[model samples]
Target: MPKLTFAADLQWRRRFARAAEGLALRFALEDARDLRDEPDGADDPDHVPLPVHRDDYDFDACTDMFFQDTDVLMLYNARFDGIEDPGGETNQQIGMGDLCTAAWFDPFGNVKTRDPHRGFRR
Candidate 1:
């Protein structure tokens, strides 16, 4: 991985700081104190879907579980690929498909994991 320049680092910091602002996140009751692996209603045959918006449930239990903290990722860069003077030392020959790890697919339907040897052989 190429070491990003100071400017690039600053840009990313700003981007993340921006994304963190006014971010409305959803959360269940924090009264449990421990973490848990709640099964999805659709996936769990025994799970009854929560009624629309409001239902009452007792908070007291043997709930010894905690959830992973929400991770905030801001996918932005001062320089990008596929254009003239895209900057950021993007040499796609040696298999660094993109400087970005967040763009799973591009507009042209090309995945970001393309390599010279990962395609059809003629």
Candidate 2:
């Protein structure tokens, strides 16, 4: 199954956090409206997710994270950094509107420079 639980989030987030810390990259995390049933977000920080794909379009619109208030620090997908929904309609919604905010920075902490750090784009 696709990993979507808190355990998975911890693994991925910590990996990214470590690398960011190593580079001395500075950033702050905003509050998140997490979906997982937890006591609170402060005690359990929410992690940014890459492009998500939900196979079952018929049952749930699966725009599960659309309203999530947390701003993403960075989002790197191997290719086409876009969310995928089987039906195609939901993808359009996310693309056209409410695309989650992502904060990308270089080693010096410049956000979205024209040089495009590591050739990654917004």
Cα lDDT tens digits for candidate 1, 17-110? 4433223222244422222234443345444464533323323331222212221111223343231122434433333344342321222343
User: After superposition, which runs of candidate 2 have C-alpha atoms over 4 Å from their true positions?
Assistant: 1-11, 16-88, 96-122
Root-mean-square deviation per candidate: 16.3, 15.5
At residue 13, candidate 2 shows an lDDT of: 55
Off by over 4 Å in 1: 1-8, 21-122
Alpha carbon lDDT of residue 27, candidate 1? 26
Summarize candidate 2's per-residue lDDT along 1-122 as a digit string, tens digits: 11221234444454444445422311211112232334653244343333445542221222332322222212233232433232346546545333332212223333332432333222
> Could you tell me the lDDT of residue 118 within candidate 2?
38
Instruction: Candidate 2: give the clashing pairs.
Output: none
**How does each model score on lDDT?**
0.32, 0.32
Against the true structure, candidate 1 reaches a TM-score of 0.20
RMSD to native, candidate 1: 16.3
As for candidate 1, its clashing pairs are 34-65, 34-66, 35-65, 35-66
